[model samples]
Each structure stands twice: as C-alpha cells, then as structure tokens.
Target: MVRYVVIGGGIVGLATAHRITIDQPDATVVVLEKEPRVAAHQTGHNSGVIHAGVYYKPGSLKAGMCRAGQASMLEFCAEHGIDARVTGKLIVATDAAELPRLRALHERSVANGLPVDLIDGDQAREYEPHVAAVAALHVASTGIVDYAEVCRVLADLVTKGGGEVRLGARVTGLRRDGATTVVETTGGAFVADRLVNCAGLHADRIARLAGLTPSARIIPFRGEYYELRADRRDLVRGLIYPVPDPQFPFLGVHLTRMVDGSVHAGPNAVLALAREGYGWGRVKPRDIVDEVAWPGLWRLARRHWAYGLTEVRRSLSRKRFAASLARLVPGITTADIVRSGAGVRAQAIAADGALVDDFLIEQAPGQVHVLNAPSPAATSSLEIAKHIVARFDE
Candidate 1:
C-alpha cells in the first residue's frame, strides 16, 4: 500500500506527491486523478499568468504563497526548459472615477512587496502601444506561461521520484481503514496511510464525502473569452486591464496576450449554472437548483444585482461584451472578436454570502483538505505544495 494518496491530478496534487517523494524517499506515494491527464480542469483551463501577488491582502496565505510562488515558478521554468516569459502586465483606469481605486490598488501591490510604477495616460500607452487609460499601474513581474506544461513537469518529477500517478481513477467514496485510508475509485481500490484532497471543482463535495464540512460551497463562475481576429492582434501589444470593482469578486473584461502569441480580448465573468458548464450549450439541472436554492447565493445576488444583470447582458450579447473590452483596447469592436474558449473558476462562497478571499486548508489527524484555492493557484502550485508538506512538520 502507498504511504500517501494525493487526490486530484491537478498541479497542486501532482506537486504534493512530488514533494512527498522528495522528502520521504522511503514512503510510497500515489496521485489519483479522474481524468486521463493531469491539469484537465482549472490548471489546464487557466489564463497562464504568473500573478505577482498584486490583488491579495498582505500577510495572508494568498499574498505569501503568490509572492514565493512567483519566484519559484520563474526558477522552475528556467531550470526545466519551459518556454515561459515575463511579459509584464498593466492595470489601467480608463476614467477619472476609477483613478482613485487604481491608486489604492497600487498601494496594495507595493504593500505586498511588488514593485509598481504609477504612470499617466501617455506612459501607459508606451507600455502597450494601443492600451487606453487615464492612469495605470505597471507591474513588471506579472508574466504568462502554459500552466499545463508546468503540471506536466511536476507529474514527470513525481513519477521519476517513485511516486505513482493513476489517471482515469474517479474517487467515489472515502473511509478510514484502521491507521490507513481506503480511497474507492472507479478504477479500483487504493489504500494509503494519509490522504490529501485538492479536487478543484468538486472540492466541497469531496470534503463532505470524507465527513468534513467545508464552510463554503464551490460555486462555479464561467469566464467567457473572445479572441481578436488575426488582423487586429497587433492592436494589443501586451496585457491591458481595467480597474476592477472593489465590491465584487470578478475582475471586469480586458485584453490579454496568450502564450501562443495570439491576443485574446475578453472574459466576462458571469455565474455558471453548471460547475463544468463551458458553453450556453451545456447545463446541469442539479447544479442550477443547488445555486438558486442557496440563501447565501440569493444574498449575494441582492448585494450586486445590478452588476449581475449587466454581466448577463454582456454574456448574452457579444456587442456589449466587446464594448467592455474596448474600455482598455479602444481598437476592438464586435466584428473584431470571435469565440475563443471559456474557463470555469471554482469560486467558493460561504454560507454567509462572503467570498472566501484566500486559500483555505484543513487538517485532521491523518488527512489534509484544501477547501478553497482562489486565483493565482496555478502560479502558486509548487509553492503551495511546499507549504502543504511543511504543515506535516507542524
């Protein structure tokens, strides 16, 4: 039997198993994933940005891990022959009303130890020749990479270190077996001395299956993106973003340059009726019922109904979505964009309607469960795994 079983074959789980193999060479470790490959969900579907600890509150796990993760990620990418680049990002304010919030965000970035440059409209334009802004904050460290590649590297190291990665292994139930745990999966039964759960979309459900109550439920938020037509790609030289609404969790639509050298201009954040719902073409009745029946969700809607309504409008109407994206990249129009793809963010909401703004991990005598890991998770995966193993020492 393996000494440890890391559930969820996403980057975190793979990283966790890799760490165990490195530290506990004699202990057998295995990672069980439901999909046929690693990083099939949040990790693979990410925007691949190396977040610079800009948006997080200082001293929290998000801030600490993201800061450490940025360094670690750059180092790993350099050492592992990954094609990651430090393409700097801009947080732009297109109107005077947003300038104050932009300044506050810059302050927060500085507090989090990120070097930020405050610039006027002219300086902002210099960073991205086509970007629009009354003022902006240039964060030089924010970069982009294919996280799917990072996950692959972690899996390779884990397996070569004597850890096993079992794909197509859908875990169905969990029960304590004497001093060990029996993880029942669709592939077969696997027993281990300890368990770690990092299931992204199904995190809460998996926690409840293990007899733990995660204070929040994983509410899926679908971010629909659009790619600029090849002819308009030059219109965006680099990343262009808007001053996010401080009251809400979603960062508004903006322009982003992908690692593939293509420019994507979109991502309207809207509530997804289904957890894995990628398109308006897909829906799960149970997912919708669960969301609508939650009092906390209703409370959240009441607090931001107007914004929510607008998000739906932008989602259903490409013209409105294009206009929102045009706030930062004025060259874009409805005709200049086409449907690219969508990524589902596993946003965890509390019973009290508050968004869990930081990473949440819980531990029992023989298990650890990551309940909520928000944005920058992909950037912070390796660092997060290091932290997870360190917790065992505590």
Candidate 2:
C-alpha cells in the first residue's frame, strides 16, 4: 500500500487524499490543515460556480478537467445529498466591441465539446431579463454549489477510507530520507512514502520547503464581492457574466445567482496586501515586502497598469463597482448592493512576466506540487486528483 501525506485541507488536497484511499483501500493517508477547520482560504471564499469549460483554451487541462469535473461534481453532490444546481450561465456581449471575443469563446466552447449555443439579445434577455446584451453564449452545463460543503464531505470520505485529517497542523518543513518523506508540522511530524503539495496560497513556499525551485511565484489578488439586496435579488435569474477583457486574466465582474438563492455581484480583482487578505485592512507587512520585492510583480503591473487602475477604482468606490456590473445588468445600482466578503486568489506569475494561464503541476523526486489552480479549481478538484493519482501509479 502507498502511504500518502497531503498538505493543505482545501478541496483539492481533501479530494486527493480521498481518491488515494479509494484507489488503494489499504493505503494510509493523512491530510494536514493549518486552520482549525477545512477550506479556510480560497476554497471557502470562492464564488462557488462550477465552470463549464468556456474560458479556457481547447485541449488544455482546464477545459478537459472542467468538463469531466463538472459531471463528477454533480454526481458526487447528488450521491452525498448536497445542494447543487445547474443554473446555467450566459456570457453576454453588451456591445459590438465584445462580439469578437464572444465569438472566440463560442468557438473554444464548441471545440471543447461543451453544450453551448450562440444566442442573440432577445434569447439572452429571455434567459436573464435584467441583462443587456447584443449577443451571448448560453452554457447549459454551468452550475453552482457551496464548495465548502463539498470539502466537508470529502474530508468525511477520507476519514471513512481509514485516513486521518489533522486540523491545525501547519507544515513547516519537508525532508527526504531513503524512500520516505518526512513532513514537519506544527502539531507534529508525519512520515510517508509520498508527499502531495496542494497548499493553494502557500504552494510556492511549500515547494521550496521540499527543496524544489518552482518556476513561478504566487501573487495574491483579492476579488471583492457585493451581495444583491433581498428585494433586488430578482434582477438576476442565474449566472450572468460579461465578455471578459482579453488583456486581463480575471473574469470581469459578473452577477452570480448562488445556490442559497442570493445573488452576488462585482468581484473586482486588485492586489491583496497579504496572501489571505480578504479585505484592504487585513494587511501583512512581510507579504507587502515580498510582493514589492518580486520583479515579476512589477513587470506584470507595468504591462497592465491601466487595467489595474480600473480595478483599483472599482474596489475603492461602490458606485464604480456597481457601474461596471451595470454594463451587464442594466437594472443594477450601487444601492442594490451590500457589503460582502472577498476571496484572495493565488495567481502564479513566471519570471518572464507572463501569468500562468493553465493548471501547473510540478513533480520532483518524491513530491508533487500544485503551483497554479485559480478559478474552476474547486470544480475540477476530483478530475485533478485522478490525474495526479495516475502520475503516482505510473
């Protein structure tokens, strides 16, 4: 039996641990989480949208994993009696300027074999009456669920498989001895045959701890959100997204109808002061120093300063945030929004200044590091686990 030690208690790590035990019933597994509870970082703070492989390049892992993962996620949710819904999504082009990108996304969607269709403004409005669009891409497979709940269920599955999840166990170091890998955590040390690094926010640091020099550095970007007021929640029927700007890596602010029946709007992406900084006030001095010290950050900023300025403006002004959202849904206004929590994304940037666009998994002597897993990661967790397990088996 292969003994496994998975770092981080997010959905990906939990899924990996659970899949390992499932594939090898007699295998021993241990999941180490820094927080008292699971999904404390990106997994819990996410918008909870199950992406439909629309935005990613065709043939990329994101596209394939998303398609397969969406199915697996729904199946898993159904089997576990979790609340998950295929609310569908519309990627609307508000004006002629966005038509080219919209068509491009449609082509990618079709190439990826996703269930999608190009619709005119009338059809778009039929799906979401509040949206203002000249054209739209209707993705039937898009869905929403509380991913944190999914993490909880995964932890239970891991436990049921004879695995142990140690809470408040922060991994401080990693060392290799013969064929065994020793993981040093705050709670204690655990030795195993293999180590899987799924530490979403601190993945890079974890790689270094394992004596691997990762090619990319993680830069945290805080996506601030606002919830629609109870009375104004009717403005969004389901997920309504804008044709994202090609220059920016972020999916522009969109209106998402969550599983709990509330609508969320405007996740303006801006540089977070800390790795887990959910708000502007939650700053870490070391994080700021590291960010400023990274040349890749400056290179990225210099390239996209104008777009970054817009995001900063929206982040600071409620009216500006609502106005950006209004471009997609005309009925939305600043008053219709209320303060909501933010999610910090661990976006990886290479030394050459380019942002890593796809999922990156690096394998060394006895370790595997998940370097970049941004949006759709929660949606693709199960499929990713399968791929990682395949690598281990090979």
Candidate 3:
C-alpha cells in the first residue's frame, strides 16, 4: 500500500491527512506534530473569524479558495455538530479619506461574487448601533467558530479513518532513499512514498531540509490582541473592521464577536524574534540570526520602518490600542479592554522585499511544501486539503 507522511498538526496538515484517508483508504497515513496536542500554535491562537472573501484581490488563489472554503467549512461544521455562527461583518470608513478605499473594496467584493452592500452611516448604525462610520461595506456571509475545536474534530476523523497522529514528534532531518522520502524525527524515522510539509512557521526551513529551495522566507509577525471586559462585550454585536491601508497586508486592528460571545480587538502586527514568538519576551538567538541573515528582512524593514514603529508603539501601550479601536466605536475606552493572548503569523517575504500576498505552495519530486498560508487559511482549510490531495494524482 502507498504510504504518506505529513509534517505539522495544524488544521491544514490534519485536513490533508483526512483527505488522504478518504481518497485512498488503503494508504498508510502518519501525521507528525512537535507539540503535545493538536492546534497548539496558529490554529489555536487565531481570532476564529470565517472570512467572506471580501479582502483578497480578484482572481487570486485566496479569493477563490476562501469563497469555496466558506461553504465547505460550514457544511463540515453542520455535519459534525460544531457550533458556528454567521455573524456578518462591517468594514467601516470613519473619515472622508477612507471612503474611496472602502468603495474600491466594495467593487472588489462584488467582482469576487460575494453578497456585500455599501451602506450609509445610518444603515450601518442599524446593524451596529454604536459604530462610528461615514460609510461601511456589510458582508452578510462572514461567520465565527472555534478553530481549535475544528482541529480536534479533524484529528478524530483522521484517526477513525485509520490514520496515525503522533504528537511530540519533532522532525529533525529529511532525506531521500530511492523512490521514498525518509523523515527523521525525535519520535523515530519513517519512510514514505510522498511527503507533505504544512509546517506553517517553519515551512521554509522544512523545504530546505527536503533539499528544495523555496522562493520566499517565512517572517514571523506577532499579532497582539485585547478582549473586552465581560461587561463591555455588549458594545460589539458582530465583527467591525476599519478600511485597511492598501499598502500593508494586515487587516488592521478590529473587533470580532467570537463563538462564545466575547468581543476581541487589536491584533497589531509587529516583527517577532522567533518563529513561534508570541510576545516580546519570547526571543530565540537562532531565530534572530535567521531574520538578520536574510537580505529581504532588511529591505522589508527599510520600506515599512514607519509603520513598524507605529505597531510597536501600539503593542506597548493599552491606551494607544484602545484609542485605535475607539475610532470605530466611540464608547470604547482603555478601561473596557484587558490584555489577551497573541498569535504569530507566518508571513512570507520574497527576495525582492515584497510581501507574498497569496497562498504560496511549492512542489518537488516526492514532496510538497506549503510556504505561506496566513489569515483565511483556517477558513479555507478543507478546500486547501482537496487542492493538495489532487496534486498527488497530478
């Protein structure tokens, strides 16, 4: 029987394994995760907003996958009895300067074939009474769910389908032996007919380990968040976002009403010292060396130094963070929010100093490497699995 080895236990890896089990029931599938449990990193740390395909560029991989993934994700949730809610989202433009960008986003949304409406401030107020907006794009299909729960369910399904998910199995090396690839791990070595690297933050490293040169390097960006106090959660009924600056890839700090009904805010992007760095205090020398050694890092910094400084300032001060949110909802104040957890994004930067804005996947002989998949990845996890599995046949 054919055997496949998958590295990383995030949503993508588990979903890929599950797809393999379903598509090739006789194949032996093994999943290797360094952490002791599934969803220990990115999948567990995100804000859990199901994207409505509003922000991606038209005709991009993200736009197509996200639109299809939303429906597949909801169907899976319904079949598995996972609690998910269609909360809808509002992209608000508080000032005249932002109106044009908001309008452009509306046109892009329409082009992407999403159900979006451009509403005046009064109409936006009907949805979110406290929101301050000159105009807003209301996307009715956006939703929220606990992705960690989704990961857990995917793990269960993989196991039930005869796949093995081994935790605490960190990969140390990779080699090719004849027609098979040998994956060396702390747990032991396993040989497989094919290998899939969904290592998220460590994807570039994994690609190099597999004897392939990737087009970009993964740069870690820590996204710090804040949650409203229990009493203040009522201020947000759903998701409320600001008009994103077109130059930057991040969708600036915004408020999201989670599955549990708590409101989360402020995920300002800042450079991380380590691939898994969740805070300023969590620094690793090797990770720092990797960043400094890359020419793209310096080039990227030179271009966005001003914006980076602003993000750092926001990360350091709760008052400044709250002030940014207050632009959307006038009543929110520093006293209403408390420091919550943070997540590190595995953003890819090309050698030319440009941020890779699309889902990047690299394939080589007997191996596939997922180089970049940041936001909307969780929302698009199922469809991404199908896409990857189809490659084996190709």
Candidate 4:
C-alpha cells in the first residue's frame, strides 16, 4: 500500500489529509503535527471569517481558491454539522480617496465571478446602519466559522477514513531513500512514499529538510485584535471593513461580528518577534533572532519602515486601535473594547523586500511544501488541499 505523510495538522494539513483519504481509500496516510493537538497556530487563532474572495485580484490563486473553498467549506460544515453561515460583510469607503479603491474592489469581485452588491451611501447604511461610509461593496457570501472546530472534524474524518494523526510529533529531519521518504520526528522515524509539508509557520524549514530550496522566507506579521466589551457589542451589526490600501497587503483594522455574537476589531500588521507570539509577553528569542538575520526582513523594513512603525505604535496603544475602528464605525470607543486576542500572519517575503502576494509552493523529489498561505488561507484551506494534491499527481 502507498503511504503518505502530511506535516502540520493545522487546517491546511488536516484538510489535505482528509482529501487524500477520501480520494485514495486504500492508501495509508499519516498526519504529523508538532503541537499537542490540531489547529494550534494560524488555524486555531484566525479571524474565523469565511472569506468571499473579494480582496484578491481576479484569476489570482487567492481569488480562485477562496471562491471555491468558500463553497466547499460550507458544504463540509453542513455535512459534519458544523456552525458556519453567510452572515455577509461590508467593505466601507469612508473618504473620497477610498471611493475609487472601493469601486475597483467591486469590479474585481465581479470579474472573479463572485456574488457582490454595489451599494451607495444610503444602501450601505441599510445593510450596516452603524457602519460609516460614502460607498461600500457588500459581499453577501462572506461569513464566519470556527476553524478550530472544523479542524477537529477534519481530524475525525481522517481517522475514520483509516488515516493516523500523530500529535506532538515535531519533524526534525528528512531523507529520501531508494523508494520512500524518511521523515525523522521527535517521536521516531516514519517512511512514506510521498510527503506533504503544510507547516503554517515552519513550512520553509520543513522543505529544506526534504532537500528543496524554497526561494522565499516566511516572515511573521502579528495581527492584533480587541473584542468590544459586552455593553458595546451592538455597535457592529455585522462585519465592517475599510477600503484596504492597495500599496500594502493588509486590509487595515476593521470590525468583525464573530459567530458567538461578540464583536472584534483591529489587526494592525506589525512584525512579529515570535512566530507564535500572540501577545507582547510571548516573544521568542530564537524566532526573533532568525527574523532579524534574514535579508528579506531587512528589505521589507527598509521599504515600509514608516508603516511598520505606525503598526507597532498601534499595537502598544489601545486608544490608537480604537481610533482606527472609529473610521469604520464612529460608535466605537476605547472603553468599548477589551484586549481579546491576536494572531500571527505567516507572510512570505522575497529576498528583494517585496511581499509575496500570491500563493507560493515548492515541490521536491518526494515532498510538496507550502511556502505561503496567509490571509484568506483559512477560507481557502479546502481548495488549497486539492490544488496541492493535483501538483503531487503531476
């Protein structure tokens, strides 16, 4: 029997394993997760937004995958009795300069073949009354779902489909023998006919272990968020976003109505000192050292120093974060928010200081490595898995 190994049991890894088992029933699959359980990193700590493929360029990998993955995720949720819905989101343009960007976004959405409604000032207000904007693009299919729960269900599906999911199994090394790829982990060595590296944070390292030189490096961008205090939750009826600056990759701070009825805001893009750092207190010295030593880090810093500094300032000041929130919803105040949580974005950067805007992958003799899968990756997890498998087949 053919045996396959999937590293990283986050959403991407779990979903990949799930697809493999479903497609090849008789094949043996093993999922190795470094953490004690699944979804410990990006998947567990994401915005939980089921993206509607609005922010990407038409025909880009992100656009295609998010659109298809949105539908597949909903179907998988319904089949597994998961909680996911199309609560919809509004991308608001509050000022004159942002208006053109908003219009361009609407056109891009249409070009991507996504369902969208272009709303005027009054029409936008009708959808989200408290949301402040001159015009907006309403993506009716966007929604929120608990990705951690979905990861659990995917783990269960993999097991039921006769696959083994090994947790706390950190991959330490890789070697290709005559016919099988040897994966050396903290637990032991496992040999498989093929390997898949879906490590969200450490994907590049995993690729190098398998003897493939990936061109890009994973730079961590921490996205800090705050939850509106219970008393002020009503300020947001649903998701509210800004007309993201085209120059930078981040979509700016905005309000998101979570599935649990609470509202969250702010996710400023700051360089993360630690790959898994979720707070000011969670910095990892090794991760910090590695980032500083990378040329790509220096390049990005030199180019976006001012923006990066601004994000750092916002990270330290809750009042500043609330001010950004006020741009989208004037009703929000500093007192209305409590430091909810934060997530690290694994942004892939090139050697020349350019941010990798599209999905990047590298393949070796016996392994497939996902170098970059940020932003809507949680939304595009299902489709990405299928794409990875297709590449492996080729």
The TM-scores of all predictions, comma-separated, are 0.97, 0.98, 0.99, 0.98
> Could you tell which candidate, 2 or 4, scores higher by lDDT?
2
Q: Give the clashing residue pairs of candidate 1, or none.
A: none
lDDT of 3 by residue, 62-81 (tens): 99999999999999999999
The TM-score of predicted model 3 comes to 0.99
User: Which should have the higher TM-score, number 2 or number 3?
Assistant: 3
Looking at candidate 2, the ten consecutive residues that score lowest on lDDT are: 243-252
Candidate 4, residues 173-292, lDDT tens digits: the string is 998898789999998999988899999889987887888878988888889889999888888888999999887779899888888998888678888888888887888998888788
Candidate 2 TM-score, C-alpha based: 0.98
Candidate 2 local lDDT, 56-142, one digit each (tens): 888888989999999999999999999999989999999999999999999989999999999999999999988899999999999
Whole-model alpha-carbon lDDT for candidate 3: 0.94
Q: What is the lDDT of residue 345 in candidate 4?
A: 88
The C-alpha local distance difference test score for the whole of candidate 2 amounts to 0.92
Alpha carbon lDDT at 139, candidate 1: 90
Instruction: Give candidate 1 misplaced runs (Cα > 4 Å).
Output: none
Q: Give candidate 1's error at residue 47 in angstroms.
A: 0.9
Per-residue CA lDDT of model 1 for 1-394, tens digit only, reads 3488899999888888988998898889889999999999888876778889888889999899998999889999999999888888899999999988998999999999898899999998888888788899999998888889988998999889998899999999988878778899998998877889899888888888888877888888888888899988989877787888877666678777888988876677789979888887789999898788777788788788898889889999989988988888888889999998898888888888887888989887678888888678888888889888877678
Clashing pairs in 3: none
Ranking by TM-score: 3, 2, 4, 1
lDDT of each: 0.86, 0.92, 0.94, 0.89
